[model samples]
Target: MALSKVFVSLMLLISLISTVSSTGVIGGKALPPKKPPVAVAPAYAPIYSPAPSPIAVPPTPAASPPVYAPVRRLIAVQGVVYGKPCSDWGHDTLMHASPLPGAEVRLVCHGKPKENPLKIMATTDKNGYFFILATKKVSEYGAQKRCRVFLQSAPTNSKFIHSTHMNGGLSGAYLRYTKPAKPLLFALYTVGPFAYEPLPSVCHQKV
Candidate 1:
């Protein structure tokens, strides 16, 4: 009608500019070609290890304990008992070394026998000489103090006599001491001239 109403208002202004350039709006504010900003990763943040080598490690010395040797402890003893003539076997003669008064001596303390009660006998003084002084504390110094020197009984019962610890008077004679480089309150033992013989098989049993 006017040119077909001006060509129908120029096709409704080109269909509203093609519906706002296919909806990427424009003045309503959406242009659409930006997308590049999504990085976000820090919930603890702390990982960097490499620095330790100045060089130094020396610590090891612990082992030294054992040096034992100082135990010499025996206290006293001294002796002599005589009377010879069984053909003077242990010859300590001065005309058969006499001195054997009354006899009977016994200081047998082998391992503390009953706490040292060997009845403590010690006779022989007319110069037969005998001494024993130790009421407690003996044995120590290579320790094996079977302390003996027995010649118990026999100044003379004369059945042809016998005593060098007479196997019959019960074997004895082991008390020896001498250690003095410095240490003494006792310990000077000199046992024996312990003798007695006369039994040539009792003169062959009165042949």
Candidate 2:
């Protein structure tokens, strides 16, 4: 009839807008609101690269303490430390041999370090000749009217007489025993010798 009612009213308005655009109500397009599901931020559980810190311990070095030395004896007195034109006591030389043959000769036994302490007994061999034998505490070594002996050319092989004297002699050694003491024959100390003038006098009488 009128073009079949304008083609059946545009075919019922395009079949009610394609049946409300597939049920999304109205002329479709509200489907865009579903974009809320695009929040895909839940897959970050694989970043396990963290674990390194522990190593530091090194410091240790401390332990040392102990040393006390002093014990020497063997006394036999009958000496000689000549130099300075020395000869006579059996008359043997015009200074025979020792201008300084590794010097050092001391027999300090008269109230040593303190009361009675000087017993380096003996030392001097290598053409210098020294024979010590004084260490028995000499009856506890306590009766010093005198027993002073010294020839400290610093013995112990005085480096070939300090390489050739300069002040080597330093001279000294003396004795004056008198308490039933008499076995000291020819005590000759040239470089140096003393008793009241050498050095000795502390004090002792114990037993």
In terms of lDDT, the best-performing candidate is: 1
RMSD in angstroms between candidate 1 and the native structure over all alpha carbons: 13.2
lDDT of model 1 at residue 203? 44
RMSD of each: 13.2, 16.4
* Model 1 segments more than 4 A misplaced: 1-35, 40-74, 85-99, 102-129, 132-190, 194-207
Question: For every model in order, what is the number of clashing pairs?
Answer: 0, 17
Runs with alpha carbons beyond 4 Å of true place in candidate 2? 1-14, 17-19, 22-35, 42-108, 112-130, 136-147, 150-207
Residues 36-132, model 2: lDDT tens digits: 4566677777878678776776767666666666433223454334332122212333244343333455555555456855556444455445555
Measured with C-alpha atoms, the lDDT of residue 115 in candidate 2 is 83
- As a TM-score, model 2 comes out at 0.29
